[model samples]
Target: MRVTIVMAALAVLATAAFAQDSPSADNGKVVFDKWCTPCHGAVAPPEMPFGGDGLPGTSALGVKYRGELPAVLEERTDLAPEFIETVVRGGLFGMPITRKTEVSESELEDVIAYLTRNNN
Candidate 1:
């Protein structure tokens, strides 16, 4: 079990190492708007009040939640970048992993930056 954890951590570090190498925030922005924007918004179910106006390709969660559905993530300011990347790569039960193909490395970083911004 310990070895598994270490291996996973190493793998995550490697991926993040490469992610840091990606130097295109513009590409990241595009990737975010396309994929991450659907479920990682700031509003909740009742507040934003999704009117069920989903067209094709829209996420089912988006219909019920906001674009920033993972509200708790916003609160975790001290969280590790690698942890966030892993969660995004291998999604939670309610969330789907945003594959590298779906979003470029820079794009993922940009989305993380955008989400972590202190707009509040």
Candidate 2:
């Protein structure tokens, strides 16, 4: 009986440890710095607004969206997660493909968590 109880306690501890751990904003930040910052910069726009006028480069959607991402995403949550996943995987219009080939499915989930932040 004592051995069984000890095993049950170990199982409970293991479950708690695993449940408390999850990939979140910090992991998303690393992915963003590598994949996004070159295009979008650190903060979203209206705060740091700029178009290609200053720099002879990309069309900087940060400035284009102008803080509208939260609203748009909130309004359009009816679209399935797969749709967003496909868009992220393929890239859109002139944007380059966002994900490195090595990124796993779970990392994509982390990115989604970052995008649909609690602000909305």
Name the best candidate (by TM-score). Answer: 2
| TM-score, model 2 to reference | 0.53
lDDT of each: 0.59, 0.54
**Candidate 1 structure quality by residue, lDDT tens digits, 1-120:** 999999999999999987777545465456656775456534434432345332212335454446555234444345456776887898866677777787757667776665455434
Clashes of 1: 7
For 3-105, candidate 2 gives per-residue lDDT tens digits of 9999999999998887556657567656655665555443333322433432211234324556554223323234355665787788776664655564567
lDDT of 1: 0.59
Report the number of clashing residue pairs per model.
7, 0
TM-score of each: 0.45, 0.53
TM-score of candidate 1 against the unseen true structure: 0.45
